[model samples]
Target: MKDLPADARPREKLLARGAAALSDTELLALLLRTGTAGRGVLQMAHELLAAPVDGGFGGISGLLHAGAEDLKRIKGMGGSSKRAQLVAVMELARRAIGQQLKEREVFSSPGAVKQYLQLHLAAKPHEVFAVLFLDAQNRLIAMEELFRGTLTQTSVYPREVVQRALQREAASVVLAHNHPSGTVQPSRADEALTQTLKAALALVDVRVLDHVIVAQGNALSMAEKGLI
Candidate 1:
């Protein structure tokens, strides 16, 4: 990487033109910093993303789930220091998103919830059912992951969901889960689960505002589709 002209380097380009001007690979190169023998930092970054760690292109979502050991398996990332840096960077992003969600009020509109949850859940390698409990005025009370299951299915218990809502004294809630297959379309089971949770929460005088299915880069709201 050092052989390149100073203006062509990832760090230099970022400083001169801004981060928006860099590609995903370039951003990754910045994080990696250097490369192993015979490989440029940019080449190493490309390989890190291209490795089939999670069956698909190990994009940002794969990186989010990667551990220090997983990173060590990458050809140029054997060093503990680099692996720690990568893990710290991913954690910082998650916490920053969490802080942002905590500061905002959740509303009937699904935009904010989708944007916030997508950062944390969309990249997950397995099924996770979660809820954002809200106050009477629709402010966030808590966000909890209630269930986790295999790659294809998660068993969501409406009773457990209701108990958590009641425990938190929540007035309303937003339901969400991710499709690791990168599809935002809700399955029949998803609709059934939503109805079950809605009825359960309603029994305690709490409302289910929406059920969102998050995919790689998109989300679907059951309420918007009139399925809620």
Candidate 2:
């Protein structure tokens, strides 16, 4: 890094150009700070973002879905403090998005909802059924993981979803879940469950805004796909 011209450095380039101008590796290098004896920080960053075959998370989004053990597999992430820092930063990202939803209408930024759900659920080893309760203005009231099941499927009860919505006094809700199998495509059973929940909620004057399916680095909005 020192041999590289001052202006060419990540910190310098970021200062001159802006964070968005930096590549994924450059952004990561800024966080990583330094590398081991033989490897440089930039090289370490490159390795960290490399494909699974190369012992990396594959990309920034993939890293977001990585857990403590996953971080342990990386070369420079062995230290407890570094792992803790990465975990804390990821949690902050989730909280920041949650705050944004709380302040504005949820659908006003549909992508945010997908990102929020991914941050919360995509890393799981098993399936999870969760819901976002929203007020009349469509702002998020609360999000809850109501059920958990096997890798392939989850046994969700409409009655429980309805009860939670009532407890939150929500006017509308968004259903979401993760496919640990890395598929964002909604199954027939997923569609059936959405319809079942929609009808049950409608009985109590609650609206089903959308159902989002999340996987590593991808998300599908059922409403966007005309499924909801």
| Candidate that would win on lDDT | 2
TM-score attained by model 1: 0.87
Backbone clash pairs for candidate 2 read none
Per-residue alpha-carbon lDDT of candidate 1 for residues 1-228, written as tens digits (9 for 90 to 100) = 678898888899999999998888899899888888888888877877774753324677667767788787678777898889989998887776666555666664357678777766887778888998888778787889988874222467787888999999999999989998889998888888888888888999999998988876788888889999
Q: What is the alpha-carbon lDDT for the whole of candidate 2?
A: 0.88
lDDT of each: 0.81, 0.88
Per-residue lDDT of 223 in model 2:
95
Instruction: Score every model by TM-score.
Output: 0.87, 0.91
**lDDT tens readout by residue for model 2, 1-228:** 777899889999999999998999998888878887888889988887898788988787778777777798888789887677677777788899999999999988998999999988886778988999999999999999998885222478888889999999999999999998999999988998899899999999999989999988889999999998
Write down the RMSD of all candidates, one decimal each: 2.7, 2.0
The alpha-carbon deviation from the true structure for residue 136 of candidate 1, after best TM-score superposition, in angstroms, is 3.3
